[model samples]
Target: MKTTLTVLLIIQLYGLASCAIKQHYFINQMKTWDEARQYCRTNYHNLSTFINEIEKQQFLQDAVNQTSDAWIGLNKPSGTWKWTTGEVTTQISWDTGEPDNDFCAYLHKDSKKLHDRDCSNTQTFFCMKVTVNTVMVQQSESWEGALEYCRHHHDDLASLSSSRSMTDALSKITGAQTQYVWIGLRFLAGGWFWISGDDLILNVWSSAGPPQCPAQNQRCAALDKNTQTWTPRDCEEKLNFLCFK
Candidate 1:
């Protein structure tokens, strides 16, 4: 009986460990910001783009054994920050009037904070693959239908990265009669990401991450009417969607 119970426990643990999460490759060799970007694009995805504390922590943790700073996917070419993920970066914690230089962003080796350097500065960089796959037309689509349409049209279902962006997505829903639209909020491997990610900035949730793991069926997200918060819903449900240009 004990042996049987041990086998059952092992099965449960293995099941919990499995998910659709994709991993990215990190290179230790130092190179300039543009060189690093070229290398990452040729070999893997763009430089790393982190949406929240979870991703930030994961990126840092992956480099726990590293010995130098690294270039990320953020750049201020025209005096504004832009993430390679195509999302406008509005959620970064600046370090004491940072971006003091306006070229590239890198994770500081010792501080773990961000600092901008000249684009030509050579540094080790993190490279990762773009996993949020697919595309669709700029029209009304159900969650599943949208997923299908996106896959067919070279778009993927939409994902809002934070609570603030929730309002931006909400603006796309034209009529009040339209109950709610689908946003790319998925649950896998014990965490949430925007394609399923959110850092709740409101006072309602104590932490930046989701307050709790959503129910199994509640794998998609929509705005909550009362508190203006985002909550997970069934993916099969039809709703308005927001997409990038």
Candidate 2:
């Protein structure tokens, strides 16, 4: 009886260990911001969606062995905060007074704390790929020029009818930080609209607000630098655009 009981206890312990969540890491090196993001989404799951405090703590602990910073799926284009995974940010784990719309998001090496960064700057990043494979691409475009550029190259700016579509798009183009691309979206007729003319459904505007309708003189849209939200600006203003095929 004693031997049988010991065997059963060992079996129970094994089952508990099996149920524990498995954490994986990818120490990607020498990739642009966009490329790093794409790598994580395509190779792993969506780029490290840290929704709660526990996950954030675990991620930092996991990265304790690493020496460089890693890139999570947080970016501000045209003044809107979005995850490369395509799911809207229902919850966030930013450090106190963080995501101030400075420009970008980075994970510090020592503290593993995430910081907002400028999109133009370059940095190394770590990508957390999940067991479930998903991808998405959220393009940022404002004016007719950028819109035309995307239409000419990739499909219209990004549209997410469901979470699956968002994940698929993100997986396709993970690493991007080199050049910004254009999406199939713009401010038209006093409202936010997609190139497909779909209703303004998924609103992810930053702190400021949505892009205003283009004025007669100003025929384009540009993201506000301070707020990281969309606003009406001259299309002629030069800015890097995001494109996905």
Candidate 3:
């Protein structure tokens, strides 16, 4: 009996450790899509990176029970789908016939599924906080200007790789109404593309598909308030941009 009890105790301990290894991290509050993206980038490496279908399912299950709609690291810039962490999407478990290009990406609580959302539409975000040292440099330029500034100084704008990283970045710069900052993302050409010219293999455009460039000369991108997805806007338009060291 004593040996059996010891074995059971060991098994229980092992189970606990396994749970910790795969624990889901989430923010306690809600935030806008841009704000949430920045939040994750500042503290963590990037937005939370979903490993596989099981991890994605577990995140949805945990978020459904929570108050806020969690933010995943998915974004469509220039009609190209990529994670904030600069990693190309490999595995996707979207609902049958999902990621219809509209504007934004969201998670449906009732269905426990993911959907595209408008960039401007505000929603609650879930961030996974992690420990990392990040450095921010100041630049005097508009959002698009800042992107140019980063290109001149360092690599492209910051990228979100994981969900925990996204949460951590969001937590660091919480508060104030003007929390949204520009990322390396922008809509260029007719398709949603990135600053680094990385091809977006994972597409999550809204139902109407991606928005067409207003003009042939439109090379810059911005989040259109009307659509919420990255649209080819005049880069000269005034907006906020985020720079990383």
Candidate achieving higher TM-score, 2 or 3: 2
**Clash total of candidate 2:** 41
Instruction: Please provide TM-scores, in order, for all candidate models, with all chains considered together.
Output: 0.48, 0.41, 0.40
Q: Quote the lDDT for 52 in model 2.
A: 49
Residue-wise C-alpha lDDT for candidate 3, range 133-230, written one tens digit per residue: 22243333454456556546754453323444234334433331223444444443245554433234323232354455545434444332233334
For all candidates in order, the CA lDDT equals: 0.58, 0.49, 0.48
Which sequence of candidate numbers ranks them by lDDT, best first?
A: 1, 2, 3
Q: Which segments of candidate 1 are over 4 A away from where they belong?
A: 1-24, 132-245
Maximum-TM-score candidate: 1
TM-score between candidate 1 and the true structure: 0.48
Q: Give the TM-score of candidate 3.
A: 0.40
**Compared with the true structure, what per-residue lDDT tens digits does model 2 show for residues 65-131?**
6667666777765576665543335566566667776756777776666778766566676666443
